[model samples]
Target: MDLESFLLGAVYYYGLFIGLSNFEFDWNTGRVFTSKRSTLYAIGTDSCISVLYIYYWTGNANIVDAIFGKANLLHEYIVVIMTGLRITTGLFTLIHRWYQRCKMMDLTAKVVRMYMARPQVKRMSRWGILIKFISGSVTDGLQMAIILNTMGRVEPQFFLGLGLQYWISVILNMAMVQQYMIMLFVRTQFQLLNSELRQVMEETKEVQLNRRHQGVFMTRCCSLADQLEDIARIQDELQTIVNQLEKVFAIRAAMIYGGYYLSSVGTSYLAYSILKHGYENMNMTLSTVILVFCWCFFYYLDGLLNLYGMLHVQDDYREMMQILGERTLFVGLDVRLDEAFENLNLQLIRNPLEIKVVELYDVTRRSTLAMIGNLITHSIFLIQYDMEHF
Candidate 1:
């Protein structure tokens, strides 16, 4: 609906990747637009119905069978849902409560936006945009190829019926990528702040001194202190957003981790069964591979995003403030930048960004390694169980 003017599809798909929607939120009005909802509903209904009808009419096996330990189809649908959920919940936490996350980040982004207006930053940003675009396109192309290629055996009319679902999936995938990319870019912008502040200090140190210079130096230090105060506010807001997201992530972690465990372990079981049972069908094997790929792709992507956006930023931020405080300007602030920086540093240390899945486990590199270890162990157990019992 009015796709050209509004980025309607992208925004709506972006919404769904968090909770579910293909609509525009008017920040001013606080309303989600309904222009395309009817169309989306029609298509979604058709896709779901087509899958069911195809199962009955064409005798296609239940997709869930393959999901548990079989392989009737690839990740074409599952990734669309899982990754959408990952991004959906993420964006929800950010955008909910009146754009809480966006508003908080926007303060720092405002500063970085000025810095980014510099020629070098603009050029790098343009290139970064291009590379990200190309990389995402390539990834989708591969995913589409696998899905359509594997779907070739399906009846033509039935296959064609689900085209809109697939189209939306690609759009949603792109949106999901966009969300994480923006999240990462925001962190990078903050990092740029670190460099920018340090440069200002360096420049101040380089200037030669006179009586007038002392006056100028004090004025600049006062200005720096003011900026640090704003940054202190930013740190506070960012911590609030992180705390809320941690709770959201905690709920999400359970679903994602359980999904990975089931899909990974089940796909492995099915693959072994295929080889052992000698179901020489290429479709089965191809689907299994795609399923496994989906599990790994979203699972690891989720980890990396959290690692960089949440974990790394926590440490780097605290350290940045510490170093900034050690600067001569902050050391001599009449109002005491030291206390502000110290409080910010202590807050960050006390509440390092963390993502806990259902209060069960925190997402970290160590946890990731352990998850893999456990998955492998469980897969082995599944194999042994099948061999002994079946």
Candidate 2:
């Protein structure tokens, strides 16, 4: 009814909209990683805080009415119910996040197993898993703290302070996550190059065994080595991107936390000023309404700022995933069969010079034909094999 209460309601509903919108957008975009569960917790806690504000204001109104003999119990009861719902919502969010974390861990384990099969690229996979675990744990801890504080009836100032701390922690953790991902990508590139190098070395061994093949083998090895070197160069560029991300996160964290503290202090001072000077003209209802609006406005601003940070973090994560997805090698049957046949031919060709060239050629041609037929048959076998495994 008053302007302040109306604004408080607007702020609360607006925050609800923003929070829900973010949840829906992230879910659709597939950016909901393990850390996102914590975000849902945060949104729930914020909604609870808003409800608490409403309850506090409504109670204050009832107290004023009792003293002045003006009835406002209906409003007070409505707000109390809202408070209860908010608390329940917060509890549900906590449980949801806990369940999601467990599921995420299970998925992560599966991913690690898949990565280990890479053998050459296992180190990068391990690093990625480690970083994700650390980041997820820290985020979940922070969210838990917020849930406890809300349920335990913490003072508003202390709650805001803790929220700011969590924000800083989240930003830093995200930065570390990004850095780890870049390192993982670098490691993957190295693994690929290492595998290429091993192949080149095997070719070099063939050249060593037969001095006549030295020039051709050396040229191919050199070309492959050059490609590996180029990959290294690209990794260096990726490292530079990681460095830039670190700097951006550091600066952004400082600004965000700094702004949060400054805003809190400013809001507190503003409330104090209004309470001290406006008492003569303002009724208790008006004062309570003003306080509610102030709290809600501060929360709204904090949510917006956090949303910005999350968007940045999510953008980087999506970019990294996109890159990784693109790099996934699609080992076609044709390619694999060609490689297998080539290896087989190379091994068979290393025979004694007493073998006639014509006989060797005939053997090579026949072997090639046999290999082609076998590959087609085996390709069909693999389809059945995969179906059975699935």
Candidate 3:
């Protein structure tokens, strides 16, 4: 199957598993198929699942675990808070998907068309997807198995609850992967567009070099105008896709980033505790610590991959803007060509296609570094507090 088919198929099946959707997508065409009855049923099921999930976790572990419990390890509280944040983020993502399903479908269609137009550049292979799937499955499965085995005599109800939790986590993780792929696809289109523009600019300069006949020069200028108009139209569509992507993904991205921060702080604390005090001091075994850190390594790696993917989008947009700036506007070119260039430049300025988190800030290198700085600061403060108090 093609990349789009594989990606959408995974989303459709995973959505069904999580009650995120009941819609079907064509394997070849990327068309969404759904009916009122199915959508209503899916919504009802999703609501029930949400209610059940919240209820299960609420009674399973309360906030008191962090504050009043006898086992007040520094990471115990962090784990509790991480669980809450992850569940909240998952719920938000599910609801957001339902709310923005139409736009997602539209965006998918546009992206699929772009893929079809340039199949040669579709470099993603099925093996890449399979490897990712296997790696995540193995890591999370091992972690869950370790937890269950450590508990001793896991009941069916508890196992099912954990299973549901696993499903939610997997879906949320896949959502990040999907968002990264979307950005990758957009970046590819931008590259193609920039290449085309560069070629046109070269041709324009070549025509300028050999401008012996007035008729030939005028004809070439008109052709340049048409090419600019076409590129501008494509650029406009890409901008729309980028906007819709932000609308569909911004809140989820913010939530995921919050989840990442929590996970990082929590896991870092756990690793620190294990290292500083030893697992025996915390009533944990070496194996448990090893497994926890192993799982966390993969999880953090996934988050970093998505974060870097967002950074690449910003990088590519900058490159495109530079390419546009290099365009030497030929004198006496059609007025329409000047207008197209002006319009394109204005759009780029106004609606820069940078991956943003809820319209608050662009995910640039500086912002990411600042976030890491804050994470380190918070972690150090927590470690010091634990040293003095606990």
- On lDDT, the candidate that comes out on top is 3
Q: Give candidate 1 misplaced runs (Cα > 4 Å).
A: 1-22, 25-139, 154-175, 200-214, 244-253, 267-311, 318-333, 346-351, 358-360
CA lDDT of 380 in candidate 3? 88
Evaluate all candidate structures by whole-model CA lDDT and list the values in order: 0.50, 0.39, 0.71
Per-residue lDDT, model 3, residue 222, is: 80
Model 3 lDDT per residue over 1-390, tens place: 666456546655765655665565563575666777668877887787688887776675443332223445556767768877887888877788878888877877887776766664456434434545555556567657655654553444465455566666866777876776677667677777888888877887787688889888878778887887888787888778878888888888888888898778777777677677776766666676677777787877777766766677677778878877865556655566667767777878987776677989778899989989999998888888888987
Worst 10 residues of 3 by lDDT: 62-71
**Pairs of colliding residues, candidate 2:** none
- Tally clashing residue pairs in candidate 3: 0
Q: Per-candidate RMSD vs. true structure?
A: 7.6, 24.5, 3.6
Give one digit per residue, the lDDT tens place, for model 2 in 1-390: 543234323432333332321221121132324346646655676465455544554542333233223223332343344334433443333334344444433333333343344444544345444534444444445454443434244444444433433443343333334334433544464455445544544554454455456466456545544543554344344344433433333333343333433334433433443454453332334534444454445443433334333333334333433333322232222233234334433332442111111223211335436644754564445334434542
Instruction: Mark the 10 consecutive residues where model 2 has the least summed lDDT.
Output: 352-361
Superposed by TM-score, candidate 1 places the C-alpha of residue 136 at a distance from the truth, in angstroms, of 4.6
How should the candidates be ordered by lDDT, best one leading? 3, 1, 2
Residue 77 in candidate 1, Cα distance off native in Å? 18
Relative to the true structure, candidate 1 reaches a TM of 0.61
lDDT (Cα, 0-100) at 152 in candidate 2: 44
